[model samples]
Every structure is written in C-alpha cells, then in structure tokens.
Target: MFKLNEMAVKPVMIADAGFMYAAKMSGQASHYDLFTPDAGELAFLADEIAPHPFYTRGFMLHTDNKVTDLVQRAYEHENAAQYLLVKGSTDYIMNQTGLLFSVDRPSVESMEAIGGTGDTLTGIVTALISTGMNIPAAAYAAAKINRIAGLYANPTPATQVIEIINQIPRAVEKVLKEDHGGSF
Candidate 1:
C-alpha cells in the first residue's frame, strides 16, 4: 500500500468485504480512506479478537440499531478506516470523531432483499471520491444517490442488481441537481 502514497496525486482508497477484512487483518485499516461495511461486517471490525467475520462474537448483534456502538468499538480498536460508510437500512457516514450523516429517506425496503445493494453503495462512493469530492461528503452523497437509485428502480423481491445499476445515471443527476446545484 506504500506505493499508493508514492503517487504524485494520492488516490482516495475505499475498501469493502474481503478487502476490508484484509485491511483489518494486516493491522493497516487506518491506511485506507474509507470502508463500506454492512452491520455484520462492522461487527467483525468491532471485534478486535475475531480473525474473520464468521468469528465475530455472538454478543455483538448485527443489527442496524447497534451501528453507533459498533462504530465506536471499531474506532476504539483501531480497526476502522479514516472514514466509515456503514451500509444498512439506514446508511451511516462517520469518522473517528462521530457520526456525520444517516440517510434513510426515499427508503426502498425491497432493495434490502436484493443482492449487490451494498456493493452498489461502495461503488457510488468510490465514483464520487474519484470526482474530487471529499471522502465524508462523497460518502454522505453516495448514500443518498444509492437510495435514490434504488427508489427509481422500484425494486421488488425479484429485482436484479443490474436494474438498480441502470438507474445510477438518473440517480446521480437527481442527487447532484438537488443537492449540489446541478454540478458535482
């Protein structure tokens, strides 16, 4: 990862799932700029003793309500990145200091049952970061964009991730127009 810092223009690094696990295991999670984890994965990060997500303690409930506590624990254990975008029913954007934003509006309940929603969120955040937006702001905006996309897709139990993916352009346009005055 040191090579990343060697670049003339340092890239904003974001990790999810397996990459996040690798970062935590290597004791270098702080080296990255952002981590996008669902509550279950956050539980893994919070458990400093857990070697893998499967080993996360049973006491650490993987529920949306426990997100704040798990985030604190993850930071306390130094197993979190500089920024965390906890993806769940209510997406949370936070840093070491505390929570910055929680996006649950335009809620699309059906999206939860569809696979790749969390991955889609991470991708949106990455794209936003690539556009020169600050990590925290990108995370917040990405959450909004993702939910908006899900809403536009009108997902059902059978909705495919590609259906949501197809709406990303419209979602980005809507979010930027509404939130950023039609520009990134």
Candidate 2:
C-alpha cells in the first residue's frame, strides 16, 4: 500500500497500535508516518534490540529509565517509526532525532484500564493530521485531548468508552481556548 501511494499528494500513514507486530514481522515499521504504542508494545519494540528477550511490563513498571532506554533503542532499530507516540502514564512522542515531547495530564487511570481508548487516540490524531497538523503535533495534541476528554467524562471502572469519546469536543474546545488564551 505504501508503494501504491508513492504518488499521493500528501502521503501519510497512521499506524494502529497492532501494526507494531506486523511491522516487526515484515521489517517495515519505520516506513509509516506514525505509530502508537503503549508501554507493553514499546517493550515489544525494544525487545528487538537484544538477542535475548529482556523487556517486560513488570520491569518497565519498576524501572525509571526503562522507557527512555527502550525508546532510544527502538528508535534505532531496523523498523523504527518516523513518528512514535508511546502511550502510558505519559505519552512520549519521538522521531529518529530522539524524544520530541511528552503529554500527560488529567491522569485518569481508568482511561488505561478501558479498552479502545488507544483506538480513540489514533482516531483523534488521524483527524488532526488530516487537518494539516504535523504528525508530532497531532500525536501530542491527541494525547492531551484524549486525557482531557477522559477527565471531562470522569472516567471510572464503570465508565464506558463512548462516554469518554463524547467528551472529545469539549476537550478540543478547552485546548483551543487555552492555546488562544481564553479566546475562541
């Protein structure tokens, strides 16, 4: 598909979280424009750096420098992404140049516990990118929007994904207002 779109006016690819597995297998991860991965998925990418499988969620959770090390290693790997959004307590946005920025706020732990939240983030980023935002900015803004939406919805163990999703407009509005300094 990438080859097919070589002539596209604005060639952009939005990789879903699972694309990491396929890219790892096909050795084509870095070919895409963007990739979204949670900590576990980030670990999976980092595991490719070593001959032995040493990355695990438990270790990532316990180690302070694990994410930084893993991201650096993964960014240098054969299939490293052009733009990567490592989703966790904080979302680390990176490129081949190295860590660009991270977005963490309205820390709703329930957002992590909920399924499809990452998919929602991908959707938000895709929309932003379609609007002419660069991959890095879109990912960063999408992370903030997703979290702000979660906060607006008051996410809890019982909260449904739709509830959080519904708050996206409010979140985007809030961000726009903040960016414009209280003006629309």
Candidate 3:
C-alpha cells in the first residue's frame, strides 16, 4: 500500500543501540551514523535555546525524562494527568530510542487494551530507520504514528491503541513527503 521501495530491512535489536544496526555491534554499519547521541543532544540544546514558538501557557515539553524529551520534542497541555504523562514520558525516553514508539503500540491480542498497535508501527518505524533515518526522526515518526493511532483508537475521549497503530504509516508518509527531509 506504499509507493515502491519496499525492500526488507532486518530487524535490529534495541538491546544493542548503535548508529546503524551494525555499528551498535561495533561500527559494522560504519557507512552510516547508526546510533549517535547527536540527534537527541541537538534537539535538547535547540529547544533549550529556541524553544518552540508554539508552546504557550500550560503547554509542556518533555524535560524530566531525557529520552522522551528527545523524542517528543513537545507536549500538549494536560490538566491532572500531566504528572503521570511526564513520568511515563521520562521512563519511556530513557529506555527507548525510536523503537519504543513502535513497541508500545498494542498487539493483536490486546483485549484489555487495543491490539496490534505495536505490530503495525513496528514495520513502519523499522522500515524508516533502516532507510537511513536517525533514532530521533524515526522516533518522532513513530510517535506521530502513535499519537494518530491513539486518537483513532478513541476519537471520542481516550485514544485506542489500535486506531493509532493502523493509521501510523499513512501519517508518517505524509510527514515524510511534506515536512521531514533533514536529520531528526
């Protein structure tokens, strides 16, 4: 359902973080910048100096958590739930690089929760990351997908994981085609 270029890329593990899958293994993906920290580092520094012009009043960004701060880039206003989201964001970021977004998506067996969210996004994020996108960009892409899926999951009150998962690739592709071209 995508435009060509569907060559399969191997699934690299999160356990071994690297610029490229091979690099994490010891600079095997030497040709690529597999797992450099620069992506998140720049995002952090840039936001610190020239924070998003969009953030007003109650708007929050992920600072408490280093990884979420790097991936989320920005956080929308939340009332009582702010504390939990902040905690979750922080926990998620430090542990995950771009892969977590996809991993967090629900699986098909999710009855207690929506299903296949992760499965759907897994393919999308992995593909993009393999195609030379860095962890942050890939993470952002996956996060965007997750958000969309979240919205789709509920579309009323709370987001359902399934809806967000299903719509991720379309949303990601749109961003890729329209706004994202450079580094993460």
RMSD of 2: 3.3
The lDDT-based order of candidates, best leading, equals 1, 2, 3
Better of 1 and 3 by lDDT: 1
Query: What tens digits encode model 1's per-residue C-alpha lDDT throughout 101-157?
Result: 999998899998999999999999998888888898899889999999999999998
Candidate 2 is scored at a TM of: 0.85
Indicate whether candidate 2 or candidate 3 has the larger TM-score.
2
Task: Compose the digit string of candidate 3's lDDT tens values, residues 1-184.
Answer: 1222243743333211222222222322222322222233223222423333232222223445454444334222110111111112212322222323223343222222444443444455556668877554665565455544454455432445555666666666555665445334
Give the lDDT of residue 11 in candidate 1: 76
List pairs with backbone clashes in candidate 1.
none
lDDT (tens digit, per residue) of candidate 2 on 1-184: 5664576564786676566667765777777788888876777776664332243445544557566787787766765678888888988888877789888787899888888899889899988889887788788788889999999999888788999899999998888668556332
Off by over 4 Å in 3: 1-11, 15-92, 95-112, 153-165, 177-184
| Candidate 1 Cα outliers beyond 4 Å, as residue runs | 6-8, 62-65
Those runs of model 2 whose alpha carbons end farther than 4 Å from true positions after fitting are: 8-10, 49-65, 180-184
Return whichever of 1 and 2 wins on TM-score. Answer: 1
